[model samples]
Target: MEFLKLPKRTTGDRSYGLTSIADFGTPVGRLISILDDYSHIIDIAKMGIGSAYITPNIQQKIDLYKEYQIKPYCGGTLFEKCYQQNKITEYLAYLKKLGIEWIEVSNGTLDIPLEERLTIIERAKEDFHVIAEVGSKDCDLDMSISEWQEEIQIFLEAGCEYVITEGRDSGTSGIYEKSGQIKSELIDELIKGIDPKKIIFEAPTAKHQMFFINQIGPNVNLGNVKLDDVLTLEAQRNGLRSETFYLEEQNANYINQAPAH
Candidate 1:
């Protein structure tokens, strides 16, 4: 009966529908202890860049993440490192031993052949929930919409759950220009050939988050988010106090005010 208690809910009382936290091992045991308090809302917890390599305790943290219904996957950069060292099979085996059900396969740093990348994706799909990534970490390297489209298709056909468009950490590299602005026209063309649902943008900035939310809607998959920014990003998605929410409210008000016979 206690579980059946339903409080009065309202749109005004809600904001984000999904939130993901980045784990940096900042008192993670204490953090997971409090996760059940918000487990119903937090959707994921990415083991942030290379932090897993620093400690063996990560396996237990990952287990905790799953216990809270949060999918915890290694960073793409970690996969890139393993691929660079030609140790991907070893990496996959390690992930399995760690009880991880998800892994990110990316070629952000090293030049992994497209055929090889496809093979890696398929191999990862054999056991883990594979998320493939596109976009180079180097700013000088540019990927055309056509190329992005083909890569998306390749990953999707190979059973990848999502293809992350690399914005890198600073949101100034890859598909994003130096000014942190997204080339919407390029994104528009890329989306023409791929399902938006299978694409996730690495939008780590507020402006980037807002632009994507406004253009692609709140449900757009975003990545590389900092640990502390999840709540703020969720606020944007749910149209809480941000300009997007205000605009929606204004539009609703206008519609309600329109003279009706």
Candidate 2:
């Protein structure tokens, strides 16, 4: 296996090249089955928006993810809903009850201003490690790259462990065009002067996955990955997939290898 292993991929608890998989409500046994195989590749199990609220199996899933050493947390949308309903205190208490250790503080759907959001983030830091998200879910709220950088810097300076750009799970909004195409120009400019390691880009599709791997190298942090695609994403990261099979070193700049549009 060493013969074909492309430049080494990071292992164990990692600080970057993170893969966040969305668990849409997998039953404990099935969840365990998936985690048993992919835990090494996955860094976080996000109980995606819808499932985070009403799912009764959250505590069990959280416990299982912890057993595998993967960070488990509910999606930001749940927090958004609680914020909308004015029950943020109750929501934080609920997360603490579930043994959750990480949290996503976002205003993608709620429009909380940067200052207000930062205050909330500071408050949440008392109980959890926070990943702050920027950008709006609607296609209409376009932001210039400079504005994006400004906001990202603010979040990072505010003690957030990482700042995530809003490429919704569909990959068709926020960082992408309405048609689901990656806004390369915007992303290209955004990553300039910014450390990719301190940010997690939500890439939900193969094209999205390959783009970041090639553009930012194998260690680019990615989120919104599907459970089934974990191995393929890891494969692509290490040049194990056909599309990026030619990758042989770190920070692969094989941008020419990007899949056909």
Candidate 3:
């Protein structure tokens, strides 16, 4: 029976979930080629900030991403530009026309009123998968943990599918320090009040990823992940890669499960 049983694995994995990846900078066909090979593992692809501005052919890449069953969306900064310029309606329509499946609603660069942000969340829910970001791009604009808790509740109620803490692709600044580390006290306080599944830490560095895996387990939601690292992240989450370091007590429990005596 012990031989038949597999090691206890983490949850939220349908064969070790790999939801994020690094940039695909080449021809759209090249991206499709990679996705075709790895579709079983890759779940989401972000084109990253303003990268789309380079070529008119970028829509072809998004189309390929959709065909591969991967949700691709514009970066939060691009959307912020749209939202700040009062082009929300056009931006939403453009995304729909382009057949985009996900959108990141963020107030990272400019100030968006809470009421307006809630409205955007609700509106995005109607047609697209919404991943709402909950931190400022500027480190100086930091809000108290209490404010974050309240903001998260409002965003959840308004229908943001996943609330991503702002790591801004570098995993430095925002909730993390300049050294690219999360403030454990703040994270603990946030977790104490919010559902872990609904919130995503934007962990862009290996250190940050390892830290979050140890602190919150592999079931934690992560965002702004690099495209090439998808498989690696999944391996860490599944306990196949030991660098993330699962809690020893958890390993002890698994070890102690009664073998037929």
Candidate 4:
């Protein structure tokens, strides 16, 4: 079946983007069907945490993701487990064997030293496209905006393709308050200091996604999105949904306006 032609929205590869999660519970057949319809709008398919281990025919799933041009990688928690077990090298090898090139390096759970994390990013870059995440997953952990800004710079300098602002799958940690409210003051500070394009804000909830899109513009890079929300989020991005429909109207008016006198 053919799809309707729509005005192209700026994708992260072209500008900024969305990274969706593919966990163990999602059936492969269902995922493939969704990809058939929406892969053009989906950028990344993160096999969240160690879901790869529990997923049936994991390699096939990875191949399907690759086939559709979706960058697929295990979540950073799996890397943390490998690191803690002193099997990071094995993890990298396994990822390569699966034909995966994109990887995430994060320290949300473990307190890996900053220098050590940078070294990991530098090393990982030799074999893979590294996506380094900043901010702790634990809500109790408090960090200053300057600290976040500094770490983001370090990750970027160390050659991470994208730096993820930690918002756990629940969207209640990292950049959000325990109640899922964004720490806007801190986000504002980070945005002022860093290039928003390089940072992927983890906005897993609808509210969080809307807030970031509204605050950072439609092209903001967002991560940790659920698989089902891919099209919904894209609709918001392109102003197809009610929440952002005003943006579509504004653009239409701009394009149709008469020349100024």
Best by TM-score: 2
Residue 63 in model 4: lDDT: 91
Candidate 1: misplaced stretches above 4 Å? Answer: 1-20, 33-37, 246-261
In candidate 4, what are the lDDT values of residues 1-261, reduced to their tens digit? 837443246643444555555554578889889889988888888888788867778899999988988889998888999989999889999999999999999999999888888887788899999999999989999889889999999888888888999989988888988888899998889888788878989988878887776677666778888888888888787667677666644544221122211
- Residue-wise lDDT of candidate 3 within 29-96, one digit each (tens)? 66667677766566667777757546578788877777777777777888888877889999889888
Rank candidates, lDDT, best first: 2, 4, 1, 3
Each prediction's number of clashing residue pairs: 0, 0, 5, 1
Ranking by TM-score: 2, 4, 3, 1
lDDT of 3 at 31: 66
Which 10 consecutive residues of model 2 have the lowest summed lDDT?
A: 252-261
- Report the alpha-carbon TM-score of model 1 versus the true structure: 0.83
- TM-score for every candidate vs. truth? 0.83, 0.93, 0.84, 0.89
Q: Candidate 1's residue-wise lDDT over 201-246, tens digit each?
A: 7777788887776666655567766666766776675566445664
Residue pairs clashing, model 4? 12-16
Once model 2 is optimally superposed onto the true structure by TM-score, how far is the C-alpha of residue 39 displaced, in angstroms?
0.9
Worst 10 residues of 3 by lDDT: 252-261
Predictions in order: lDDT = 0.71, 0.84, 0.71, 0.80
